[model samples]
Target chain A: MILAPQALLSAQQQIQRDLHSCLDYFDLPHPLKDAVHHAVMLGGKRVRPALVYASAQLDGDVMSAAARRAAVAVELIHCYSLTHDDLPCMDNDELRRGQPTCHVAYGEATALLAGDILQSMAFEVLGSRMFDTADLPNPAIALRQMQLLATASSKMVCGQVLDLQAEGQSIDQSHLENIHRNKTGALIQAAIMLGATTVLPVAHPSFTHLRIFGQSLGLAFQVQDDILDITADTEVLGKTAGKDIQVQKSTYPALLGLDAAQVYAQQLHDQALEALQQVTGNTQPLQDVTQFLLHRQS
Target chain B: MILAPQALLSAQQQIQRDLHSCLDYFDLPHPLKDAVHHAVMLGGKRVRPALVYASAQLDGDVMSAAARRAAVAVELIHCYSLTHDDLPCMDNDELRRGQPTCHVAYGEATALLAGDILQSMAFEVLGSRMFDTADLPNPAIALRQMQLLATASSKMVCGQVLDLQAEGQSIDQSHLENIHRNKTGALIQAAIMLGATTVLPVAHPSFTHLRIFGQSLGLAFQVQDDILDITADTEVLGKTAGKDIQVQKSTYPALLGLDAAQVYAQQLHDQALEALQQVTGNTQPLQDVTQFLLHRQS
Candidate 1:
């Protein structure tokens, strides 16, 4: 059920082009411009953008400019978060994507500004006239997309706050869920919702079904990540491995025991697929994505 | 011609109320909620919100709910910038508005998250349907307003980056102006533009006039701030005084002599007033506000 590697590569390339085009809007100074370019082109797996594309495909419509912009915007937010989270005051990470982190290459101040500018650029892309048609889609849809991105971003930061607060403390299951659901799950759900919203009305039943599917898949995605942190090697992971355990951060395997954690991931993956079954289209891409999340090695 | 104290007070109260109401939308945890509240409620001059109100009034219409929301959004962004700028890795300031900085009150991690959430809330305030009217204004205008905010924010951050880089370096007058224009001028201009967009079309000639006015006033405002850092005392400024010099940072007065800087501020203030001459309606409030900026202390 794995997706064709070519499909993922094409999506990444499309997103990369859209992201690069964002820089053309601003005549940024040379150093800031270079850092912004480096931040976006760090070459991580374009999973969020891929989700946007796969979700858009669910309605049998070709990817429109709106969908492409949303994909790029979500990816920009993801990249911004990674850049900031790796700052010296925060995670203090040195390596990202098998390369030196943004602050390590550009000074801390430039890296901070780069993250801030990247975040602003995300909204600019969503709000601006990125489309080529004479008649644009409903403006309310664009506003709603911005709202979704902002809300998810707020939740993601709040989750990070909670994670930082719980660093040395012994947290329970509900606490762990709160952290992951906000930290990682909110934006994942936002990616799917943003994509679905491009073609589906906010009140559509398909929207609800997709929300549930995204929620389950997002949680599954994080659980699998937690599993990989302990089981995967650094060379395969492409970043530091076992970071969670090293930092004494709680993870699914630590909280639920390794055997039960695997079982839980499988259960969430099945639930995600079940939610997609209610939709009346070819959901094979979504199914393949869910399967991919469940089995991704890095 | 100074703005009536009561008028400024009323606008400040209105903006404060709208900002507080934003918290009602989210049931945050106690600590984070308190920090966010503290960040917003650390009352300052509310000059940005006043500019928003004054600009909206230039069209001879009562302020709409949209205008109120835009005013609050600008203020929230301003607050978020101050919160982040005071972080240990950034300015590392210990006081603001005569208060212990957010990072000082809460931990650095919490303060960082608080700033991030406050920024998200700004967009939420702008994009959400907070109005009582069933018929909303054109969605394109709202999108344009958001774009202005995001662009201004990016420029402001870039300015901060430049400022950080320029510290301890002997910079020229043009470089100093560049830092202030992006760091402080962009958002101030954005506030005026946000208010004007609520009442004026994007293509309206008035928008151009207001942009010039805002740019002039924003730069003048920063020059005055630099002058006050040397001329004013800590108790009157309500923040640390002379910290710019203490940090060995470049300022307008440092690049240009203090007397020439004062003359430059007066010139910019005159330019701001001249831009208002082309505006159609009774621009009394704007005129009074600009006069206040040119002459006020503390």
Candidate 2:
């Protein structure tokens, strides 16, 4: 059966339902809840969550309760990061995904608290009930997943710190790679790992192969993001385009030239596909995800 | 026989060592690591960590790796809350524990990220290895603890939201109670519950009684804090004194007369001890801690 790149739209809708159900379970103060909803429900591409189930090799339309928890967990972390990053003190963006940013819609303080609580909610979901299949769900899986999420979350923050410190400075390619690898790459790898964890033990050889696939794909995705920032207009991008250059951020185009960066992106894409080839199980979803990421416009 | 209030001094030292060791385990970027260390290490009274061990009813000097995790987790959350609460947009306090606030010591962005990362670190610590004694460590215990902590942490943020909204408004005692219950009482209850989880199951009778003890003590502690803010100087308080009144916040002393607030504090203290009486374990440490909380001048 040919799966023409697992339907990201389907995964997006399913994740929205999962996220809505999770939010409905809690009754927060009105403003806080509204802010959280605005921040989360305004919605992005749901690429990370889609990657989660894809890496798990689940059918595009099927749901694993365990994988749902992980998908929600990563999405929450991603949403919260965006909210806080949009704060006046951080990236200071006024819009995200074609809507007023969280801080702009809700005041900065509300947005900050909303972001902070979303993070706690992520762990709450993850540490709760696991896959129903594990008659007695293993604690180690949750522990290992929590550890991975925390580490990635930490690295992501570290990357931001590096980004903030490196602003306005011309840095080399190596430093630039280090920054993206953590800033965006860490969480991307984490999403893939969490999904893989749903089916594989921590020591499985497939994990080794999966990690390489995640690493290469993550960089390739960032490289595409860089390319789009220069190529796409704000209307198409749903955010202010050319932001990387505006902020004087060191990007692939800036360091390696647009031509070399495009070539590098293709190289990374090929590398990612090669790594996935080593993994067993229905690797089709991941393969589709990799191909989709390499060619996505926004 | 008597534990001298379970020697909060000792717990503070051990938790400090534990936190320092945790920090040393990671080689974070220089500025971020420094910010985290400053936020975690510039030491508060360690009241929450002390409560963790006190509720566990362990010998003052003895260490349980299990209880230690709970202790560290709550402390990390408390520290991060303080760091965020002290932000210019929030409380705007420059001094904490008689030193510069995190935002003041580090830049606002770095301080924000530090507080943010400290939260992830808390779950990282909690969801990792469990008690050394559990032949096969149970995931339920960690899940329960994480849920309690997350819930309490969420409530605390809500309380802050309410408090922010209540600024410049004349609120009733019950409203103030609602605010304090979420902000301070929830976490206090969580600490007691987490410590109890170390030695007791979820449905243990002692947990019910211990919760009441925690509720009353939490209120009493906040009531005492209100009294201290009104009566103490900045030097003694280590934070801005009389600032609550300056900000027109509704406090116990603000709603009730100072003399009446003191009377109410004593009544709450008595109520706390009354609840502790129903517990069957080594109640001495808890009793001592409650008494210490009642009389503590700072």
* lDDT per residue as tens, model 2, A42-92: 877888998898877632435567788889999999999999999989989
The alpha-carbon deviation from the true structure for residue A74 of candidate 2, after best TM-score superposition, in angstroms, is 0.9
Q: Please give, for residues B35-112, the per-residue lDDT of candidate 2 as tens digits.
A: 999999987778888889888873343556768888888998999899999998788899999999999989899889
For all candidates listed, what's the TM-score of chain B alone? Answer: 0.95, 0.94
lDDT of each: 0.84, 0.84
Best by the DockQ measure: 1
Best candidate, lDDT-wise?
2
Query: What is the DockQ score of candidate 1, to 2 decimals?
Result: 0.65
- What candidate 1 gets wrong by more than 4 Å, as runs, is A1-4, A131-138, B1-4, B131-138
- Output the number of the TM-score-best candidate: 1
State residue A230's C-alpha deviation in candidate 2, in Å.
1.0
Q: What is the C-alpha local distance difference test score of candidate 1?
A: 0.84
